[model samples]
Target chain A: MDPAKLLDILGNENRRKIIQLLANRPCYVSEISSRLGVGPKAIISHLGLLEQAGLIECSVDEQRRKYFNIANNMRLEVSVSPYSYTVTLHDVTFDRGKNEEDPVEKEIPPGEESSTLFLKLSSRLKELKKRQEELAQMQQQLQVEYTEAMDHCLDSIEEIARNPVECELLFELLKNETTLATLCYNLRLHPSIVNANLIGLTKRGFIEYGIKNNQYYWKIRETGVENE
Target chain B: MDPAKLLDILGNENRRKIIQLLANRPCYVSEISSRLGVGPKAIISHLGLLEQAGLIECSVDEQRRKYFNIANNMRLEVSVSPYSYTVTLHDVTFDRGKNEEDPVEKEIPPGEESSTLFLKLSSRLKELKKRQEELAQMQQQLQVEYTEAMDHCLDSIEEIARNPVECELLFELLKNETTLATLCYNLRLHPSIVNANLIGLTKRGFIEYGIKNNQYYWKIRETGVENE
Candidate 1:
């Protein structure tokens, strides 16, 4: 699987929120939408992208209502150094879909680091194959949680990008700092429209206003790239 | 470090190429530029992103030219199953920077699989703490080549994206299928310009032309996302 594409898809804050919710327990589109306070259409779009990336999967229930959850027994581990990085996708054959409950919530026995966890799992792998499979299943779920937490920082600026006017304003700000008056004039937009865009952008961490030459100038924030 | 950000940065084809080249051995900017046949400015931009993501570090040598190499003892493993994934970053402390020569060039012993490799490393961790550290350092370097090989499928499409005309044409094609003649007319560009962009995009696996309604139409390839 393409880790970069997967990263890009899950980079969305809403999508990550969806994953977090599903990682806790399976939820359908409307439930996820209501819980996250996002539109159902947007949630479905996010789910489609996640499914295309193979990050999540949907299963239909008896009433034919689709439930979304993380794909079972999927684990991604990425190790990086200065010169190189490794991505390994383990398709551990764990029956997590039916038997496991809140697979990602497996608590680490306090004070246990990954090495101990590895040893514990390794020992299990050495025992009867069936027992080994069970332990790998648990490890797989634990790993899913670990990966999601690691990527929580990559929450995307996609929501801001959904608004063309606001996105354009942010991009313009990224080029150079300008006063609201100057921006309104330059973009041929009315003062009120520009002000609204600026307000929205600022609230979303896209732009910041500061005094320059004793006048307020809006400049794009460093995290502006988080926007699509 | 933000694994998602790191993944996003490395998602670029040029950056991955830089990593692949450096993994073979450290190379200066000009040398890497020549090897990849890309312009110096683009290589520099790619390098800057990699360094910012902490995937690489640079050192200045005698004569003041900067050389780039992967950071020592950094390992990333990503495992994916249908349901979940895990990313583990290991900052193994070993003085392999001095003792190890061409660390990524370590050859696997004949008939050894990754499971054996893991088993061997796991057992070593069960030994004395110092011995475990030594084994981990070796494992860290050994993992370098393994990861590079694993991501071989994620080849870069960055070259196609470097050209605005080509990139725009590819994006346009993604919208719908259109014959070259129609695209030239609609996009208000000459046939030669459209054809050149088409060829560049096609060579990079960005688009494909096929006969529809007895006329050849261009459609964006699925791999278009591989471009930066």
Candidate 2:
């Protein structure tokens, strides 16, 4: 799904509340309306949009009453740091056929007591939760390290870059290796100015360029200074 | 920051593009406009909102040119599945005071070669990236386990619950232990109807209630069935 579209769908407070409510259990329009303390008409409209976006679905009961529930397993992750901004959406659907040896699939035995199954499942969930928390902590630590390193890189570039264009050239190169034409286009700078900065950066040992397909592609040197 | 507010800010493609641009390098208003192929007036407005939300900050250079850059280190995570929907915003700031023993902070010696420092930082970042990928895979597996367990729980409740209200009651109980008043409020059902469903569920051994602070709190029984 497009991150912008997903963000737009979730931007409304009522829509977010509806998703939260349905996350716990499926509900019909009236139940959702009353539970959310919103008008039924508004809830219906939100439901329509949610269903269209494939974020939710409806099932009809024997009485012809419709129940709405979450339809997809997905995650949206947005990270904004000094060094990078990224939005990633993952479709996390389970492929049971591919994971035939997964222990979770074989945990429940046929005709087993539902109570014991519940206990086992709940315990497994608790363990997963603990591990997730630990992973989250580790991820946080990594973010800190990333931010610190980027800050240091910026500081070093500030010392080496002689002008604003040179600064921008080095910063862009820090992200990835790219040719001069692409750099000019991305930075909205003239080709001559970008080329001059790239040459200067290479002389200062701040950046280097290699030939690919008969075009020069520039990138930040892993070891920033030369003759150290 | 509020998740809804964050979503609203990121919903605009231009604003998202602006952030993506700044993630590479800070840019002043005119530079941003030219790079994005947007008019200065509209870009300024977008920049204003971003600044107001504290997502971007501007610094004025000696030439009085204002450059905008990312202001915060944060992450927004939204998960949607059959059993849960959650939106969490994390402020991933570096608490240098708290993490005094962190090797990352101590690795860069003052006045050392910037080239060697950059190399070390880059290698450390690569290692962190590898670890993060491993953790992400583990997290995906955990989400699968959670969804499967919740599905199993729902199936068990369907077998035991005799009516819509009973099913709703059990679903609500599956989330956490709550009192009758809270359940009535959350479900938006009549007090008598909620009480009846709770009592029936308790009798059928699907749920159990305990007295706390002179009020009855109900929850799904770990062992769902009454008999072994």
Candidate 3:
């Protein structure tokens, strides 16, 4: 809303470049410019707008030169990609469980908007529910594929299911810090298979993903899933 | 971004008035301005910025123009007052439960500024984990309180523990929806109690509120609490 702030934000190419680069990791202006082959001044000029706009922030490492990072919790959602959710909640005092995540939207406030909110929440929930059902069906197809694939590789379902590296990868995911690439690299599995399993679990409504550091970060959804 | 859009959105006194009204429901312009003593154009003008900036939307209805109210989720987010997260997303697929809204400061996305995609996500996940720990401690506290409260009210732990509405409400919360308010409302409890119990659940780390409307929407944050 501030013209000065808006102009300041757009005035610099460096800041614009910083956003594009920081889309992957939080970095210093020097590292950013060196990586982009630009001058620090260029990056700062644009970063000024972003900072004014409150999109980017700089975390200082004990000095005045700020280490720049994204503002916070701004995961780039696939504009319209379908997502699934499986949730669990526990409270020691309250001995009960609850279902979570809304797919369809609902009406919330004012009057008609409430209807639309309900509609959207319901629609999204139904979409996930449908996907869950599809994944259930696809499990059968996947089972057949698994048999063919497994016959030529691991001798048993338990072997494939409990492969040592897979177990370790699962362990890391349980901690919510590992990514698909890291899992694949560490487990010696193809990225496609790792993604397939993730997507499989996602379809079952057990987990969800958002892009981070230009790759998919994988984590375990259920705390009761043995490792925890 | 566009002055015309801003003027158009707020131009109508009715739309400006609806802006105040939408704090409760997502109202269409007519429904929004319906409560107005002025014309519908008044609401439409003010609605322009709200719509253009992605704070709201316009949709078709069986009859007149329908607008999707989004300000509750984003606009009020920037307010200095407590903007509670109405839902918690437990993307167990990735071993993470995120309630990205901060209780003290809720910042909205600056328009067309650089996005806060990564920072927001990691911070959110980290915060959720921190909350889980905090809630774990709080659950212990609540258990102590509930124990004492029960001593004053009932004799048997089992009898008081089996509060059906609360349990059933918890179940309904887990089955189809992620958030609890609407479900709780549908179950016909006062929104205040629903809000309070949900706060207890959130503190215990069983559920978390994902912010939608200014009202808190909840999601189960763990995997097995419902069946546990």
- Model 3 chain B: which ten-residue window has the lowest total lDDT? B76-85
DockQ of 3: 0.02
TM-score of every prediction relative to native: 0.39, 0.81, 0.18
Tens-place lDDT digits, model 2, residues B151-224: 66666666556799987887777666798888998887999989887777677666787888888888767654
Which 10 consecutive positions of candidate 3 chain A have the poorest summed lDDT? A77-86
Better of 1 and 3 by TM-score: 1
**Fraction of the real A/B interface contacts present in each candidate?**
0.21, 0.59, 0.00
What are the runs in model 1 whose C-alpha is more than 4 Å off? Answer: A2-17, A34-42, A61-64, A81-84, A93-228, B34-39, B77-87, B93-228
Candidate 2: TM-score?
0.81
Give the docking tier of candidate 2.
acceptable
Better of 1 and 3 by lDDT: 1
**Distance from true position, residue A73, model 1, in Å?**
1.7
Best of the candidates, lDDT = 2
Question: Fraction of true contacts reproduced, model 1?
Answer: 0.21
CA shift at B99, candidate 2, in angstroms? 11
lDDT (tens digit, per residue) of candidate 1 on B103-205: 4324534322322332233223223223423433433332332222211211122223557666456434533467888777655689998898888767655
Model 2, global lDDT: 0.77
